[model samples]
Target: MGAHDAGTAGRGRGKRIVVLDYGSGNLRSAERALAHAGADVTVTADLTAAAGADGLVVPGVGAYAACMAGIEASGAGPVIAERVATGRPVLGICVGMQVLFAHGDEHGVVTKGLGLLPGGVTRLPAERLPHMGWNTVTPPAGSVLFAGLPADSRFYFVHSYGVLDRAALAEAGVRVTTAHHGTDFVAAVERGPLSAAQFHPEKSAETGALLLRNWLATVD
Candidate 1:
């Protein structure tokens, strides 16, 4: 039950993509961006709506633990897992991407994550903290997410913690894209049925729009 049917035009013309409202994320911005990218977008917390959508987008902001709590409270974690299990598409943004890992460490505290990816999030080792603002991404070969984009394309980022284990992700057969703050960290990940970005695509302007379009193309 993807968004658009077979007859719809390109982009998300008839597609039904849901922006999960798990009590986190820049919902309106994401919704608007996806709509512009041609999806029939809905921002909701309804489990049925999330599960039934053609494609699901899990967007998040703030702490990893708080986002995970909202996902649990909304009963959306199982829905996301089910979607992944069934080979349906799911995209996570920012902390949405972070929580998909095994766990996240903020300050000295650690919290369990969705454990979808075999990794943990930790503070970026750069000289400066937060790793905010725009940075260029180095997409892997044959990267569907970065397809048609420039090699040095910049994406918006506002993060303090990220997945730093590139080797583990590669060993797990996940396609990765990296960006450097002071050191390298996972900027994006593309595994079967699951794709996530540490940066906010909705806030990334044209480059972000193109990335969303690429992901939307895989919805069917």
Candidate 2:
């Protein structure tokens, strides 16, 4: 059995999770993975259903600016902010996580983010353009998202732009997780009911499943 299958042990049963459809992301894959993790999953653009769910997941792919545009066009921006303010559990994946930050600078064009988290997203200081494949992460002490996972456990990553500084987030009492591409960049972050990952857990197989299970455990 996979680590997720063994570790989750049906922990996600009965939890209602809404995968926010803002016109981006691998929606079906995320839905399937969450259901396998044991949550009753819903993929929809309906704000009411999203807001009422036990947990909310924001998934994104493609450029940072395009994802932000989708989030804005779908009218999910306010709902996401409200959910965070009300202490409801919300998870962002990939560019979904990036949009939660203050801004994203792609090439020279700067786009504003949700500002829920501090800092901006920029190209990694690496020779490679898109840092694809698997890498291990360094989760801070007391990380709920990474709890009980192996120290050397690797997660899938496929992005170039990322938040590099950990100081601002740490000062805000957010637990930061770091992984290296060319330099250390934010991998995941957890604070209160808000959590985000730079990698796609759905595509990550076992390790990703366990991470989703962990996030589900935090949902009320």
Candidate 3:
């Protein structure tokens, strides 16, 4: 059993949604999307504030090194560390997802990630640079993470790197793969209560909204 299943041994009992804001991210739109899904989300840069919140969304954009620095600087790092320790759901998106791993190989810069999940982040296949477009995501059989989500659902993506190795894929209990420019990448991931999606569900039209709605349903 992973940290999520262990920490969340008892059912969740809170409505506080903490969305981390270090320097940049699409939190504003994510907030709008979550609200549309009936979630009362709270956006903050304070790690302390995020630590105590019921659920946390670690979203990021731009440089991975800079984002990690911002998260550490804001003190949200330990909060996330603790949250992961608690087994409560902590979702990271895009660069946010990269942060969950031990490290990343981007911009020739190898920096440590949240180390929440067991693995390292690597660059996407050479065939694909920054995968920027729409694609279909097919989730694994036992995945309820995308419960009610349509199969082969299309989602918008603009990412350069993704989880590539099979071991890394298994770390994510429910493996959700998405195709980008003929290359397959892990679109959505969930390791126990810890979940994340490289594609911006907030921008994924109905498919994205369905993901958000499903996640929101598990918030409390």
- Assess each prediction's global lDDT (C-alpha) against the native: 0.90, 0.94, 0.73
- Stretches off by above 4 angstroms in model 1 are 1-9
> Could you give the candidate ranking by TM-score, starting with the highest?
2, 1, 3
Give the candidate number with the greatest lDDT: 2
Question: Which residue runs of candidate 3 sit more than 4 Å off their true CA positions?
Answer: 1-14, 126-128, 171-182
Query: Candidate 3's residue-wise lDDT over 1-220, tens digit each?
Result: 4453333322232366778898868989887766665566788777777877768888988777888888888777778877767777788878887787777778787988888776666777757567787877777776656775667788888878777665655744546554555456667777666788888887888677667656755665
Question: What TM-score number comes out for model 3?
Answer: 0.86
Candidate 3: lDDT of 44?
79
RMSD of each candidate?
3.9, 1.4, 6.4
Candidate 1: C-alpha lDDT: 0.90
Of the candidates shown, which would achieve the greatest TM-score relative to the real structure? 2
TM-score to native of every candidate shown? 0.95, 0.97, 0.86
Tens-place lDDT per residue, model 1, 56-164, is: 9999999998999999888888999999999999999999999999999998899999988989999988888788899999999989899888887899999889999
| Residue 78 in candidate 2, Cα distance off native in Å | 0.7
lDDT of 2 at 75: 91
TM-score, cand. 1: 0.95
- Give the clashing residue pairs of candidate 2, or none: none
Clashes per candidate, residues 3 or more apart or on different chains: 6, 0, 1
Write down the TM-score for model 2.
0.97
